[model samples]
Target: MTSPILRDPGNSGFVVELEKFSGPLDLLLHLIKEDEVDITDLPIAKIAVQFLSVINELGLNQAADYLEMAARLLRIKAQMLLPRRLGDDEWEDPRAELVRRLLEYQQIRELVEWLGHAADARAERFGRGYEAPPPDAPPAPLQIDLNDLLAAAERVIALMPDPNLHHRVVPRPLDVEGATARILALLAERETFGWRDAVGGGPQATLVDVLSTFIALLELAKRSVLTLSQPEPFGPMVITRGISREAA
Candidate 1:
């Protein structure tokens, strides 16, 4: 199925295969392997950059498809840069989604290739044309066994999340007094904290950080130490001095 697609037209003897790829997911795997890059320690940013040139060669027909996968690579890179730590249970392997898609696509491609080979062999055999069915042939009605159906149901249910196996821990709440002190220290250097900065984490912020920072802001508000405002709805939340710029 290898088609010898040019990996690098700039250099001679640099090629891969079009038949090996159904879309960008398969192509991404080929790209990563072409450079002899480590899958364990993925060079996401570098791979994303190189993927753009490869997609360009593929042309507008697959423009939408390639762009989607490229976005995933960039997002994974961004996720790695920010938020040094995530909750142990909450954190998911960033590469898992892409890898899953690649595996599924590869399986489908292999199956299709096998089916095509079988069809070619059948075409070469004689008496391949369809013949009339025998008269009075009893059509067998498709019957489903209850046990077989139950087995399939169990298989599907197994995929569902099991709460019994998990251990969930609730983070202890922070003291308002302590939160206030931390906020004051954060304000010592800078006059304002950006929306994300004030929250301490991005959208999926830890419950502890969010609640503590919020209580801290409330304590500051009570003392007229700081102000919170947003230009419009859904805009960035800013924290500024309410009255006097006092640390206390």
Candidate 2:
């Protein structure tokens, strides 16, 4: 059976061909933009229905990611629909979690785009080509893959100690340049630095700080300025300076 995804094409019933995506988050970004909805302020119920409807074309095997996202949306919608008692000022907004995930995914998408563009630019320019002498011994195998570096970052972040941040509005977002410099500085002072130490802390060190610092480390690792290593399974990741100036 064929399925048609509602594109919100001026009518809820108007169907459009389902386009392929890398994952459910990619599809969610498309829907959010198509519906002219704000990421920070999602229309949870409406988007929830729309998302589920759109994924009907994907079949169960290909639809797991979308299904998971849809569940989150419905759960958020359900909590929002439940009547709040009068003077219930302490309840947290259920939408916050979804919004945070959306923002984080968007950031990763942008970073990947930039890396792609940089790759293309490097390909276009001519470089000084010279013949190198034969290696004295067999060449060394590549120590790390950039994707694995990112995974290492993921592991570190997943294992991070929750600062149990107090609820407050962030006045300004974390600075990437500042965070990058701090991490580099920490590495310079010592041969290696802990993930938490590289991330730093204070009233200003929000989760955003940790995320930004991670991305900064990713960029550094991309430039071969830093490396990440784990001595044992689930041990603390060590961030150290890389001797080689090469991209993996």
RMSD of each: 31.0, 29.3
Best of the candidates, TM-score? 2
TM-score of 1: 0.38
lDDT of each residue in 1-248, candidate 1, tens digit only: 22123233343332343564667867877887799887666777778777766665655224456667767787887886776465668877787776677667767878989999999998888785777886896877646577767775874565455578585465565655666676687788688886567665464555566677888887787878888887643445788866774544
lDDT, candidate 2, 1-248, per-residue tens: 22233332243342233457667788888899899988998998778777777676454223456657777887899899988888889988999988898889889999999999999998899779757887799766657767777887996686565689456676678678988999888878888777768888853466788788888988998888889887754456789878764553
Error at 46, model 1, angstroms:
2.5
Error of 1 at 33 (Å): 3.4
- Which residue pairs show collisions in model 1? none
